[model samples]
Target chain A: MKWLRKDLEKYVQAKEYVDTVIIPVQMFQVVDENQLEKDSFDSEVLAIFANEIEKELSGRVMLAPAYTYVKGADLGREAERLNEWIKHLKQQPFKHIFVLTLDMQWKKSEASLDANLLWLPGLKPTNLQSQEAVQVIRGQIEQISELIRSYW
Target chain B: MAAGLLAPMIRFAIDPVLQSQEKSGDLVNVNLSVDDITDTPQRVDWEVQQVDGWYESNINRTAWVYKDENGEIVALSPICTHLGCFVSWEGSEDYPNEFYCPCHDGRYYKDGTNVPGTPPLRPLDVYEHAVENGMLYLGEPKPREGA
Candidate 1:
Protein backbone atom coordinates (compact mmCIF):
# COMPACT_ATOMS: atom_id res chain seq x y z
CA MET A 1 0.00 0.00 0.00
CA LYS A 2 1.12 3.54 -0.67
CA TRP A 3 1.38 6.46 1.78
CA LEU A 4 -1.86 7.91 0.39
CA ARG A 5 -4.70 8.69 2.77
CA LYS A 6 -7.00 6.04 1.29
CA ASP A 7 -4.36 3.33 1.49
CA LEU A 8 -3.48 4.32 5.06
CA GLU A 9 -7.12 3.98 6.04
CA LYS A 10 -7.13 0.44 4.66
CA TYR A 11 -3.82 -0.24 6.39
CA VAL A 12 -5.34 0.78 9.68
CA GLN A 13 -8.04 -1.83 9.32
CA ALA A 14 -5.74 -4.63 8.15
CA LYS A 15 -2.48 -3.77 9.85
CA GLU A 16 -1.88 -7.39 10.77
CA TYR A 17 -1.85 -8.50 7.12
CA VAL A 18 0.71 -5.89 6.11
CA ASP A 19 3.91 -7.13 7.70
CA THR A 20 6.59 -5.31 5.69
CA VAL A 21 7.62 -1.69 5.11
CA ILE A 22 9.65 -0.24 2.23
CA ILE A 23 11.34 3.13 2.71
CA PRO A 24 12.94 4.74 -0.31
CA VAL A 25 16.06 6.76 0.58
CA GLN A 26 16.60 9.81 -1.63
CA MET A 27 19.37 12.41 -1.64
CA PHE A 28 19.89 15.70 -3.41
CA GLN A 29 22.35 18.61 -3.32
CA VAL A 30 22.26 22.11 -4.78
CA VAL A 31 25.84 23.07 -4.15
CA ASP A 32 27.15 21.32 -7.30
CA GLU A 33 25.03 21.43 -10.47
CA ASN A 34 26.50 18.23 -11.89
CA GLN A 35 26.04 16.34 -8.64
CA LEU A 36 22.52 17.75 -8.32
CA GLU A 37 21.54 16.40 -11.75
CA LYS A 38 22.91 12.96 -10.93
CA ASP A 39 21.17 12.90 -7.57
CA SER A 40 17.91 14.03 -9.13
CA PHE A 41 18.03 11.26 -11.72
CA ASP A 42 18.94 8.74 -9.05
CA SER A 43 16.04 9.91 -6.91
CA GLU A 44 13.65 9.40 -9.84
CA VAL A 45 14.97 5.91 -10.46
CA LEU A 46 14.70 5.05 -6.77
CA ALA A 47 11.11 6.29 -6.70
CA ILE A 48 10.22 4.13 -9.69
CA PHE A 49 11.77 1.09 -8.07
CA ALA A 50 9.96 1.69 -4.81
CA ASN A 51 6.62 2.27 -6.58
CA GLU A 52 6.91 -0.91 -8.65
CA ILE A 53 7.97 -2.95 -5.62
CA GLU A 54 5.05 -1.65 -3.63
CA LYS A 55 2.65 -2.49 -6.45
CA GLU A 56 3.96 -6.03 -6.58
CA LEU A 57 3.71 -6.55 -2.84
CA SER A 58 0.91 -4.17 -1.93
CA GLY A 59 -0.91 -6.79 0.10
CA ARG A 60 2.03 -7.49 2.36
CA VAL A 61 4.05 -4.29 2.19
CA MET A 62 3.48 -0.67 3.12
CA LEU A 63 5.43 1.89 1.10
CA ALA A 64 6.39 4.54 3.63
CA PRO A 65 7.01 8.15 2.70
CA ALA A 66 10.47 8.62 1.21
CA TYR A 67 13.37 9.38 3.51
CA THR A 68 15.17 12.32 1.90
CA TYR A 69 18.47 13.84 2.98
CA VAL A 70 20.71 16.44 1.50
CA LYS A 71 23.93 15.35 -0.14
CA GLY A 72 27.19 15.87 1.86
CA ALA A 73 25.25 15.49 5.05
CA ASP A 74 27.15 13.53 7.67
CA LEU A 75 26.48 9.86 6.98
CA GLY A 76 26.78 8.88 10.63
CA ARG A 77 24.18 11.41 11.69
CA GLU A 78 21.85 10.50 8.84
CA ALA A 79 22.15 6.86 9.70
CA GLU A 80 21.23 7.62 13.28
CA ARG A 81 18.23 9.64 12.17
CA LEU A 82 17.10 6.86 9.85
CA ASN A 83 17.40 4.37 12.66
CA GLU A 84 15.19 6.51 14.82
CA TRP A 85 12.53 6.39 12.10
CA ILE A 86 12.93 2.66 11.90
CA LYS A 87 12.72 2.32 15.67
CA HIS A 88 9.47 4.24 15.73
CA LEU A 89 8.13 2.18 12.79
CA LYS A 90 9.08 -0.99 14.61
CA GLN A 91 6.57 -0.10 17.29
CA GLN A 92 3.96 -0.79 14.61
CA PRO A 93 5.65 -4.21 14.70
CA PHE A 94 6.46 -4.48 11.02
CA LYS A 95 8.30 -7.78 10.77
CA HIS A 96 10.46 -6.58 7.91
CA ILE A 97 11.84 -3.18 6.93
CA PHE A 98 13.73 -2.73 3.67
CA VAL A 99 15.44 0.54 2.82
CA LEU A 100 15.85 0.88 -0.96
CA THR A 101 18.40 3.35 -2.28
CA LEU A 102 20.79 3.99 -5.14
CA ASP A 103 23.18 6.10 -3.10
CA MET A 104 26.43 4.32 -2.24
CA GLN A 105 27.01 6.57 0.76
CA TRP A 106 24.47 4.51 2.65
CA LYS A 107 26.77 1.50 2.20
CA LYS A 108 29.37 3.02 4.51
CA SER A 109 26.82 3.18 7.32
CA GLU A 110 24.93 -0.02 6.48
CA ALA A 111 26.07 -1.80 9.58
CA SER A 112 24.82 1.03 11.76
CA LEU A 113 21.36 1.05 10.20
CA ASP A 114 18.45 -0.77 11.84
CA ALA A 115 16.70 -2.01 8.66
CA ASN A 116 17.67 -4.09 5.63
CA LEU A 117 19.56 -1.68 3.36
CA LEU A 118 19.21 -2.46 -0.36
CA TRP A 119 21.88 -0.47 -2.15
CA LEU A 120 21.68 -1.08 -5.89
CA PRO A 121 24.09 0.08 -8.55
CA GLY A 122 23.07 3.41 -10.06
CA LEU A 123 21.32 3.08 -13.41
CA LYS A 124 22.18 5.42 -16.26
CA PRO A 125 19.66 8.20 -16.75
CA THR A 126 17.41 7.07 -19.58
CA ASN A 127 13.89 7.58 -20.84
CA LEU A 128 11.81 5.26 -18.64
CA GLN A 129 9.28 4.83 -21.46
CA SER A 130 11.71 2.99 -23.73
CA GLN A 131 11.14 -0.77 -23.98
CA GLU A 132 14.72 -1.59 -23.10
CA ALA A 133 14.67 0.60 -20.00
CA VAL A 134 11.37 -0.92 -18.92
CA GLN A 135 12.75 -4.43 -19.40
CA VAL A 136 15.86 -3.68 -17.35
CA ILE A 137 13.87 -2.16 -14.52
CA ARG A 138 11.41 -5.05 -14.58
CA GLY A 139 14.25 -7.59 -14.33
CA GLN A 140 15.74 -5.77 -11.36
CA ILE A 141 12.34 -5.48 -9.67
CA GLU A 142 11.75 -9.25 -10.07
CA GLN A 143 15.08 -9.97 -8.43
CA ILE A 144 14.50 -7.52 -5.59
CA SER A 145 10.99 -8.82 -4.94
CA GLU A 146 12.32 -12.35 -4.87
CA LEU A 147 15.03 -11.33 -2.44
CA ILE A 148 12.42 -9.76 -0.15
CA ARG A 149 10.34 -12.92 -0.36
CA SER A 150 13.32 -14.93 0.81
CA TYR A 151 12.95 -13.19 4.15
CA TRP A 152 9.50 -14.70 4.48
CA MET B 1 -48.27 28.76 -25.40
CA ALA B 2 -44.79 29.84 -26.65
CA ALA B 3 -43.05 28.44 -23.47
CA GLY B 4 -44.52 24.95 -24.00
CA LEU B 5 -43.31 24.81 -27.63
CA LEU B 6 -39.80 26.07 -26.75
CA ALA B 7 -39.37 23.55 -23.91
CA PRO B 8 -39.72 20.52 -26.23
CA MET B 9 -37.45 22.12 -28.84
CA ILE B 10 -34.69 22.74 -26.25
CA ARG B 11 -35.02 19.22 -24.84
CA PHE B 12 -34.76 17.64 -28.31
CA ALA B 13 -31.60 19.60 -29.12
CA ILE B 14 -29.91 19.13 -25.70
CA ASP B 15 -30.78 15.47 -25.16
CA PRO B 16 -28.63 14.25 -28.09
CA VAL B 17 -25.66 16.25 -26.87
CA LEU B 18 -25.91 14.80 -23.38
CA GLN B 19 -26.35 11.26 -24.72
CA SER B 20 -23.32 11.53 -27.01
CA GLN B 21 -21.18 12.88 -24.17
CA GLU B 22 -22.11 9.86 -22.06
CA LYS B 23 -21.35 7.42 -24.86
CA SER B 24 -17.99 9.00 -25.61
CA GLY B 25 -16.79 8.33 -22.08
CA ASP B 26 -18.11 4.78 -22.06
CA LEU B 27 -15.29 3.13 -24.09
CA VAL B 28 -11.61 3.85 -24.46
CA ASN B 29 -10.10 3.28 -27.90
CA VAL B 30 -6.84 1.48 -26.98
CA ASN B 31 -5.20 2.35 -30.35
CA LEU B 32 -4.36 -1.27 -31.16
CA SER B 33 -5.76 -2.94 -34.27
CA VAL B 34 -7.89 -6.03 -33.80
CA ASP B 35 -5.78 -8.00 -36.25
CA ASP B 36 -2.61 -7.20 -34.31
CA ILE B 37 -3.97 -8.94 -31.23
CA THR B 38 -2.70 -12.51 -31.39
CA ASP B 39 -3.47 -15.53 -29.23
CA THR B 40 -1.07 -14.35 -26.54
CA PRO B 41 -2.11 -11.75 -24.02
CA GLN B 42 -0.55 -8.37 -24.64
CA ARG B 43 -0.44 -5.62 -22.05
CA VAL B 44 -2.25 -2.57 -23.41
CA ASP B 45 -1.97 0.78 -21.68
CA TRP B 46 -4.47 3.55 -22.15
CA GLU B 47 -5.48 6.79 -20.54
CA VAL B 48 -8.87 8.11 -19.48
CA GLN B 49 -10.04 11.30 -17.85
CA GLN B 50 -11.05 10.61 -14.25
CA VAL B 51 -12.89 13.13 -12.13
CA ASP B 52 -12.40 12.72 -8.39
CA GLY B 53 -14.62 15.16 -6.51
CA TRP B 54 -13.17 18.54 -7.52
CA TYR B 55 -10.03 17.27 -9.31
CA GLU B 56 -9.87 15.86 -12.82
CA SER B 57 -6.88 14.13 -14.45
CA ASN B 58 -5.85 11.53 -16.94
CA ILE B 59 -5.32 8.17 -15.29
CA ASN B 60 -3.29 5.37 -16.87
CA ARG B 61 -4.88 1.95 -16.92
CA THR B 62 -3.71 -1.44 -18.20
CA ALA B 63 -5.35 -4.61 -19.43
CA TRP B 64 -4.24 -7.97 -20.75
CA VAL B 65 -5.90 -8.49 -24.13
CA TYR B 66 -5.78 -11.56 -26.33
CA LYS B 67 -7.76 -13.65 -28.82
CA ASP B 68 -9.42 -16.72 -27.39
CA GLU B 69 -9.66 -20.17 -28.94
CA ASN B 70 -12.70 -19.19 -30.94
CA GLY B 71 -10.84 -16.14 -32.31
CA GLU B 72 -12.86 -13.78 -30.17
CA ILE B 73 -10.98 -10.92 -28.51
CA VAL B 74 -10.88 -10.86 -24.71
CA ALA B 75 -9.55 -8.20 -22.42
CA LEU B 76 -8.81 -9.00 -18.78
CA SER B 77 -7.90 -6.64 -16.01
CA PRO B 78 -4.29 -7.26 -14.94
CA ILE B 79 -5.04 -6.62 -11.29
CA CYS B 80 -4.92 -9.80 -9.23
CA THR B 81 -8.14 -10.45 -7.30
CA HIS B 82 -6.30 -11.74 -4.25
CA LEU B 83 -4.22 -8.71 -3.23
CA GLY B 84 -4.60 -6.29 -6.16
CA CYS B 85 -1.07 -6.78 -7.46
CA PHE B 86 -0.54 -6.53 -11.20
CA VAL B 87 -0.34 -9.94 -12.82
CA SER B 88 1.83 -10.59 -15.85
CA TRP B 89 1.52 -13.18 -18.56
CA GLU B 90 4.03 -16.04 -18.21
CA GLY B 91 5.95 -14.07 -15.57
CA SER B 92 7.25 -17.11 -13.69
CA GLU B 93 9.78 -19.36 -15.38
CA ASP B 94 7.90 -22.44 -14.23
CA TYR B 95 4.49 -21.13 -15.19
CA PRO B 96 4.13 -20.75 -18.93
CA ASN B 97 0.94 -19.62 -20.72
CA GLU B 98 -0.54 -18.40 -17.45
CA PHE B 99 -0.94 -15.11 -15.64
CA TYR B 100 1.44 -15.02 -12.68
CA CYS B 101 1.34 -12.65 -9.77
CA PRO B 102 4.79 -12.38 -8.21
CA CYS B 103 3.37 -11.11 -4.92
CA HIS B 104 2.21 -14.47 -3.54
CA ASP B 105 2.64 -16.75 -6.56
CA GLY B 106 -0.99 -16.37 -7.58
CA ARG B 107 -1.68 -18.05 -10.92
CA TYR B 108 -4.53 -17.71 -13.44
CA TYR B 109 -5.20 -19.72 -16.53
CA LYS B 110 -5.04 -18.23 -20.00
CA ASP B 111 -8.80 -17.87 -19.92
CA GLY B 112 -8.58 -15.53 -16.92
CA THR B 113 -9.87 -18.17 -14.54
CA ASN B 114 -7.97 -18.57 -11.27
CA VAL B 115 -6.15 -21.80 -10.69
CA PRO B 116 -7.77 -23.78 -7.90
CA GLY B 117 -6.18 -23.28 -4.48
CA THR B 118 -4.17 -20.33 -5.69
CA PRO B 119 -4.03 -17.11 -3.75
CA PRO B 120 -6.59 -15.54 -6.09
CA LEU B 121 -10.11 -16.35 -4.96
CA ARG B 122 -11.82 -15.27 -8.21
CA PRO B 123 -11.00 -15.13 -11.88
CA LEU B 124 -9.54 -12.05 -13.45
CA ASP B 125 -12.18 -9.45 -14.32
CA VAL B 126 -13.18 -9.17 -17.99
CA TYR B 127 -13.37 -5.82 -19.68
CA GLU B 128 -16.41 -4.88 -21.71
CA HIS B 129 -15.07 -4.74 -25.24
CA ALA B 130 -16.22 -3.78 -28.71
CA VAL B 131 -14.57 -3.77 -32.14
CA GLU B 132 -15.40 -0.79 -34.30
CA ASN B 133 -13.81 -0.28 -37.70
CA GLY B 134 -11.31 -3.06 -36.84
CA MET B 135 -10.12 -1.11 -33.80
CA LEU B 136 -10.55 -2.45 -30.26
CA TYR B 137 -12.27 -0.31 -27.64
CA LEU B 138 -12.52 -1.40 -24.04
CA GLY B 139 -14.79 -0.35 -21.19
CA GLU B 140 -14.79 -1.03 -17.47
CA PRO B 141 -14.02 -4.57 -16.33
CA LYS B 142 -16.76 -6.54 -14.64
CA PRO B 143 -16.27 -9.30 -12.03
CA ARG B 144 -16.91 -12.85 -13.23
CA GLU B 145 -19.19 -15.18 -11.31
CA GLY B 146 -17.51 -18.62 -11.58
CA ALA B 147 -15.40 -20.87 -13.79
Candidate 2:
Protein backbone atom coordinates (compact mmCIF):
# COMPACT_ATOMS: atom_id res chain seq x y z
CA MET A 1 0.00 0.00 0.00
CA LYS A 2 1.06 3.59 -0.54
CA TRP A 3 1.94 5.91 2.34
CA LEU A 4 -1.23 7.91 1.91
CA ARG A 5 -3.99 8.58 4.42
CA LYS A 6 -6.61 6.39 2.70
CA ASP A 7 -4.21 3.51 2.25
CA LEU A 8 -3.01 3.89 5.79
CA GLU A 9 -6.59 3.61 6.97
CA LYS A 10 -6.91 0.36 5.03
CA TYR A 11 -3.55 -0.74 6.40
CA VAL A 12 -4.75 -0.18 9.93
CA GLN A 13 -7.66 -2.54 9.37
CA ALA A 14 -5.67 -5.18 7.43
CA LYS A 15 -2.34 -4.76 9.13
CA GLU A 16 -1.91 -8.50 9.25
CA TYR A 17 -1.67 -8.76 5.43
CA VAL A 18 1.09 -6.18 4.99
CA ASP A 19 4.34 -7.88 5.87
CA THR A 20 6.88 -5.79 3.96
CA VAL A 21 7.96 -2.16 3.63
CA ILE A 22 10.03 -0.30 1.09
CA ILE A 23 12.12 2.69 2.13
CA PRO A 24 13.59 4.74 -0.70
CA VAL A 25 16.93 6.32 0.25
CA GLN A 26 17.53 9.62 -1.52
CA MET A 27 20.56 11.92 -1.41
CA PHE A 28 20.71 15.39 -2.84
CA GLN A 29 23.09 18.35 -2.76
CA VAL A 30 22.03 21.78 -4.00
CA VAL A 31 25.45 23.40 -3.79
CA ASP A 32 26.78 22.09 -7.12
CA GLU A 33 24.50 22.72 -10.10
CA ASN A 34 25.81 19.76 -12.09
CA GLN A 35 25.66 17.38 -9.16
CA LEU A 36 22.25 18.72 -8.18
CA GLU A 37 20.67 17.79 -11.52
CA LYS A 38 22.19 14.30 -11.47
CA ASP A 39 21.13 13.66 -7.91
CA SER A 40 17.60 14.82 -8.65
CA PHE A 41 17.34 12.53 -11.66
CA ASP A 42 18.60 9.56 -9.67
CA SER A 43 16.20 10.21 -6.84
CA GLU A 44 13.32 10.52 -9.28
CA VAL A 45 14.15 7.16 -10.80
CA LEU A 46 14.42 5.59 -7.38
CA ALA A 47 11.01 6.99 -6.47
CA ILE A 48 9.53 5.55 -9.67
CA PHE A 49 10.94 2.14 -8.85
CA ALA A 50 9.61 2.28 -5.31
CA ASN A 51 6.17 3.31 -6.51
CA GLU A 52 6.03 0.54 -9.10
CA ILE A 53 7.21 -2.02 -6.60
CA GLU A 54 4.51 -0.97 -4.19
CA LYS A 55 1.84 -1.28 -6.88
CA GLU A 56 3.05 -4.76 -7.80
CA LEU A 57 3.07 -5.86 -4.18
CA SER A 58 0.26 -3.70 -2.89
CA GLY A 59 -1.32 -6.57 -1.00
CA ARG A 60 1.83 -7.29 0.95
CA VAL A 61 3.97 -4.18 1.05
CA MET A 62 3.70 -0.63 2.35
CA LEU A 63 5.74 2.15 0.79
CA ALA A 64 7.22 4.33 3.50
CA PRO A 65 8.10 7.96 3.10
CA ALA A 66 11.47 8.49 1.48
CA TYR A 67 14.50 8.69 3.68
CA THR A 68 16.32 11.77 2.40
CA TYR A 69 19.76 12.82 3.61
CA VAL A 70 22.16 15.49 2.46
CA LYS A 71 24.67 14.32 -0.09
CA GLY A 72 28.37 13.91 0.88
CA ALA A 73 27.50 13.11 4.47
CA ASP A 74 29.51 10.57 6.43
CA LEU A 75 28.40 7.11 5.33
CA GLY A 76 28.83 5.57 8.77
CA ARG A 77 26.62 8.18 10.45
CA GLU A 78 24.04 8.08 7.68
CA ALA A 79 23.66 4.30 7.85
CA GLU A 80 23.36 4.53 11.61
CA ARG A 81 20.57 7.07 11.28
CA LEU A 82 18.83 5.02 8.58
CA ASN A 83 18.89 2.05 10.92
CA GLU A 84 16.87 4.02 13.44
CA TRP A 85 14.11 4.46 10.87
CA ILE A 86 14.17 0.73 10.18
CA LYS A 87 14.08 -0.09 13.86
CA HIS A 88 10.95 1.97 14.34
CA LEU A 89 9.17 0.57 11.27
CA LYS A 90 9.99 -2.97 12.23
CA GLN A 91 7.80 -2.46 15.27
CA GLN A 92 4.84 -2.32 12.87
CA PRO A 93 5.55 -6.02 12.29
CA PHE A 94 6.86 -5.67 8.78
CA LYS A 95 8.84 -8.84 8.49
CA HIS A 96 10.78 -7.57 5.48
CA ILE A 97 12.29 -4.16 4.80
CA PHE A 98 13.87 -3.27 1.47
CA VAL A 99 16.03 -0.15 1.20
CA LEU A 100 16.18 0.95 -2.45
CA THR A 101 18.69 3.43 -3.80
CA LEU A 102 20.75 4.28 -6.88
CA ASP A 103 23.71 5.52 -4.90
CA MET A 104 26.44 2.89 -5.01
CA GLN A 105 28.17 4.23 -1.92
CA TRP A 106 25.67 2.38 0.20
CA LYS A 107 26.97 -0.87 -1.28
CA LYS A 108 30.19 -0.47 0.67
CA SER A 109 28.33 -0.25 3.96
CA GLU A 110 25.58 -2.72 3.11
CA ALA A 111 26.73 -5.10 5.80
CA SER A 112 26.14 -2.51 8.50
CA LEU A 113 22.65 -1.55 7.25
CA ASP A 114 19.70 -3.05 9.07
CA ALA A 115 17.50 -3.76 6.01
CA ASN A 116 17.94 -5.36 2.62
CA LEU A 117 19.88 -2.96 0.39
CA LEU A 118 18.78 -2.93 -3.25
CA TRP A 119 21.18 -0.84 -5.30
CA LEU A 120 20.50 -0.11 -8.94
CA PRO A 121 23.21 1.13 -11.26
CA GLY A 122 23.15 4.85 -11.94
CA LEU A 123 21.17 5.69 -15.06
CA LYS A 124 22.07 8.33 -17.62
CA PRO A 125 19.86 11.39 -17.88
CA THR A 126 17.37 10.16 -20.46
CA ASN A 127 13.80 10.89 -21.35
CA LEU A 128 11.67 8.65 -19.15
CA GLN A 129 8.64 9.15 -21.41
CA SER A 130 10.22 7.38 -24.33
CA GLN A 131 8.82 3.94 -25.19
CA GLU A 132 12.21 2.27 -24.79
CA ALA A 133 12.76 3.76 -21.36
CA VAL A 134 9.30 2.71 -20.23
CA GLN A 135 9.91 -0.82 -21.47
CA VAL A 136 13.21 -0.97 -19.62
CA ILE A 137 11.58 0.24 -16.46
CA ARG A 138 8.82 -2.36 -16.77
CA GLY A 139 11.35 -5.15 -17.28
CA GLN A 140 13.38 -4.07 -14.29
CA ILE A 141 10.27 -3.80 -12.14
CA GLU A 142 9.26 -7.35 -13.01
CA GLN A 143 12.70 -8.70 -12.15
CA ILE A 144 13.03 -6.75 -8.93
CA SER A 145 9.54 -7.68 -7.77
CA GLU A 146 10.19 -11.33 -8.49
CA LEU A 147 13.42 -11.10 -6.50
CA ILE A 148 11.53 -9.62 -3.56
CA ARG A 149 8.97 -12.40 -3.72
CA SER A 150 11.77 -14.92 -3.47
CA TYR A 151 12.38 -13.90 0.13
CA TRP A 152 8.82 -14.90 0.97
CA MET B 1 -15.08 32.81 17.25
CA ALA B 2 -18.56 31.32 16.80
CA ALA B 3 -18.37 31.50 12.97
CA GLY B 4 -14.86 29.98 12.89
CA LEU B 5 -15.85 26.90 14.90
CA LEU B 6 -18.98 26.20 12.80
CA ALA B 7 -17.21 26.89 9.47
CA PRO B 8 -14.67 24.11 10.03
CA MET B 9 -17.40 21.67 11.03
CA ILE B 10 -19.48 22.49 7.96
CA ARG B 11 -16.51 22.09 5.63
CA PHE B 12 -15.69 18.72 7.17
CA ALA B 13 -19.21 17.50 6.57
CA ILE B 14 -19.23 18.70 2.93
CA ASP B 15 -15.69 17.66 1.99
CA PRO B 16 -16.49 14.11 0.82
CA VAL B 17 -19.22 15.20 -1.56
CA LEU B 18 -16.92 17.82 -3.08
CA GLN B 19 -14.06 15.36 -3.45
CA SER B 20 -16.24 12.66 -5.06
CA GLN B 21 -17.56 15.09 -7.65
CA GLU B 22 -14.01 15.96 -8.71
CA LYS B 23 -12.56 12.43 -8.95
CA SER B 24 -15.18 9.83 -9.80
CA GLY B 25 -17.52 8.98 -12.71
CA ASP B 26 -15.64 11.02 -15.32
CA LEU B 27 -14.89 9.85 -18.85
CA VAL B 28 -11.31 10.07 -20.10
CA ASN B 29 -10.56 9.95 -23.80
CA VAL B 30 -7.98 7.17 -24.26
CA ASN B 31 -6.89 8.40 -27.71
CA LEU B 32 -6.51 4.92 -29.15
CA SER B 33 -7.80 3.97 -32.57
CA VAL B 34 -10.91 1.85 -32.13
CA ASP B 35 -9.99 -0.20 -35.20
CA ASP B 36 -6.67 -1.18 -33.66
CA ILE B 37 -8.41 -3.04 -30.87
CA THR B 38 -8.85 -6.60 -32.07
CA ASP B 39 -9.85 -9.89 -30.45
CA THR B 40 -6.62 -9.97 -28.44
CA PRO B 41 -6.63 -7.70 -25.43
CA GLN B 42 -4.21 -4.77 -25.70
CA ARG B 43 -3.06 -2.53 -22.91
CA VAL B 44 -4.28 1.05 -23.09
CA ASP B 45 -2.91 3.74 -20.82
CA TRP B 46 -4.39 7.13 -20.00
CA GLU B 47 -3.83 9.81 -17.43
CA VAL B 48 -6.40 11.55 -15.27
CA GLN B 49 -6.13 14.60 -13.05
CA GLN B 50 -6.69 13.50 -9.45
CA VAL B 51 -7.06 15.50 -6.27
CA ASP B 52 -5.98 13.83 -3.04
CA GLY B 53 -6.39 16.22 -0.15
CA TRP B 54 -4.01 19.10 -0.93
CA TYR B 55 -2.06 17.19 -3.55
CA GLU B 56 -3.20 17.32 -7.18
CA SER B 57 -1.48 15.29 -9.88
CA ASN B 58 -2.02 13.25 -13.02
CA ILE B 59 -2.47 9.58 -12.25
CA ASN B 60 -1.71 7.02 -14.98
CA ARG B 61 -4.26 4.25 -15.38
CA THR B 62 -4.09 1.07 -17.41
CA ALA B 63 -6.82 -1.15 -18.80
CA TRP B 64 -6.86 -4.20 -21.00
CA VAL B 65 -9.23 -3.32 -23.83
CA TYR B 66 -10.41 -5.30 -26.80
CA LYS B 67 -13.39 -6.23 -28.93
CA ASP B 68 -15.56 -9.18 -27.95
CA GLU B 69 -16.88 -11.78 -30.41
CA ASN B 70 -19.87 -9.57 -31.18
CA GLY B 71 -17.50 -6.68 -32.04
CA GLU B 72 -18.51 -4.72 -28.96
CA ILE B 73 -15.71 -2.90 -27.17
CA VAL B 74 -14.77 -4.30 -23.76
CA ALA B 75 -12.37 -2.61 -21.40
CA LEU B 76 -11.26 -4.45 -18.32
CA SER B 77 -9.34 -3.02 -15.42
CA PRO B 78 -5.88 -4.59 -15.34
CA ILE B 79 -5.79 -4.71 -11.54
CA CYS B 80 -5.96 -8.28 -10.24
CA THR B 81 -8.95 -8.83 -7.97
CA HIS B 82 -6.92 -10.78 -5.43
CA LEU B 83 -4.04 -8.36 -4.89
CA GLY B 84 -4.28 -5.34 -7.24
CA CYS B 85 -1.28 -6.29 -9.36
CA PHE B 86 -1.67 -5.36 -12.98
CA VAL B 87 -2.60 -8.30 -15.20
CA SER B 88 -1.18 -8.64 -18.70
CA TRP B 89 -2.56 -10.27 -21.80
CA GLU B 90 -1.27 -13.77 -22.39
CA GLY B 91 1.71 -13.16 -20.14
CA SER B 92 2.42 -16.84 -19.85
CA GLU B 93 2.89 -18.92 -22.99
CA ASP B 94 1.14 -21.87 -21.42
CA TYR B 95 -1.96 -19.83 -20.68
CA PRO B 96 -2.78 -18.76 -24.21
CA ASN B 97 -5.48 -16.10 -24.56
CA GLU B 98 -5.72 -15.48 -20.84
CA PHE B 99 -5.03 -12.49 -18.61
CA TYR B 100 -2.22 -13.56 -16.30
CA CYS B 101 -1.02 -11.88 -13.15
CA PRO B 102 2.64 -12.72 -12.69
CA CYS B 103 2.50 -11.81 -9.03
CA HIS B 104 0.59 -14.95 -8.14
CA ASP B 105 -0.39 -16.74 -11.36
CA GLY B 106 -3.91 -15.32 -11.30
CA ARG B 107 -5.76 -15.84 -14.57
CA TYR B 108 -8.86 -14.38 -16.15
CA TYR B 109 -10.64 -15.64 -19.24
CA LYS B 110 -11.17 -13.69 -22.43
CA ASP B 111 -14.37 -12.08 -21.19
CA GLY B 112 -12.75 -10.91 -17.94
CA THR B 113 -14.18 -13.82 -15.97
CA ASN B 114 -11.84 -15.30 -13.42
CA VAL B 115 -10.80 -18.85 -14.24
CA PRO B 116 -12.18 -20.98 -11.47
CA GLY B 117 -9.61 -22.14 -8.88
CA THR B 118 -7.25 -19.26 -9.74
CA PRO B 119 -6.00 -16.88 -7.14
CA PRO B 120 -8.59 -14.30 -8.14
CA LEU B 121 -11.97 -14.88 -6.55
CA ARG B 122 -13.85 -12.20 -8.45
CA PRO B 123 -13.97 -11.46 -12.13
CA LEU B 124 -12.11 -8.44 -13.46
CA ASP B 125 -13.90 -5.10 -13.23
CA VAL B 126 -15.33 -3.63 -16.43
CA TYR B 127 -14.79 -0.02 -17.35
CA GLU B 128 -17.76 2.02 -18.47
CA HIS B 129 -16.87 2.88 -22.05
CA ALA B 130 -18.32 4.70 -25.03
CA VAL B 131 -17.26 5.29 -28.60
CA GLU B 132 -17.60 8.84 -29.82
CA ASN B 133 -16.39 9.85 -33.27
CA GLY B 134 -14.20 6.73 -33.38
CA MET B 135 -12.42 7.77 -30.17
CA LEU B 136 -12.82 5.57 -27.12
CA TYR B 137 -13.79 7.23 -23.84
CA LEU B 138 -13.70 5.27 -20.60
CA GLY B 139 -14.91 5.85 -17.08
CA GLU B 140 -14.27 4.14 -13.74
CA PRO B 141 -14.31 0.35 -13.60
CA LYS B 142 -17.21 -1.36 -11.85
CA PRO B 143 -17.02 -4.76 -10.20
CA ARG B 144 -19.17 -7.45 -11.78
CA GLU B 145 -20.42 -10.83 -10.58
CA GLY B 146 -18.25 -13.80 -11.49
CA ALA B 147 -19.50 -17.16 -12.72
What lDDT is obtained when candidate 1 is compared to the true structure? 0.87
- What DockQ does candidate 1 score? 0.42
- What's candidate 1's i-RMS value? 1.9
Model 1 residue runs over 4 Å out of place are: A126-136, B1-26, B49-58, B93-97
Instruction: Please write out the lDDT profile of model 2 over residues B1-147, one tens digit for every residue.
Output: 999899867876975334333444577889988988898888898889989888898888889999999998899998988767778799778899899887567899989999999878899999877766788878888898866
DockQ of 2: 0.30
lDDT of 1 at B41: 96
Please provide, for model 1 over B1-147, each residue's C-alpha lDDT reduced to its tens digit, 9 standing for 90 to 100: 999899867876865333333465598899999999999999998878899998997666789999999998889999888777789999888999999987678899999999988878899999878777888888888898755
**Candidate 2, which CAPRI tier?**
acceptable
lDDT of 1 at A41: 85
**Of all true interface contacts, what fraction is found in model 1?**
0.56
Measured with C-alpha atoms, the lDDT of residue B56 in candidate 1 is 98
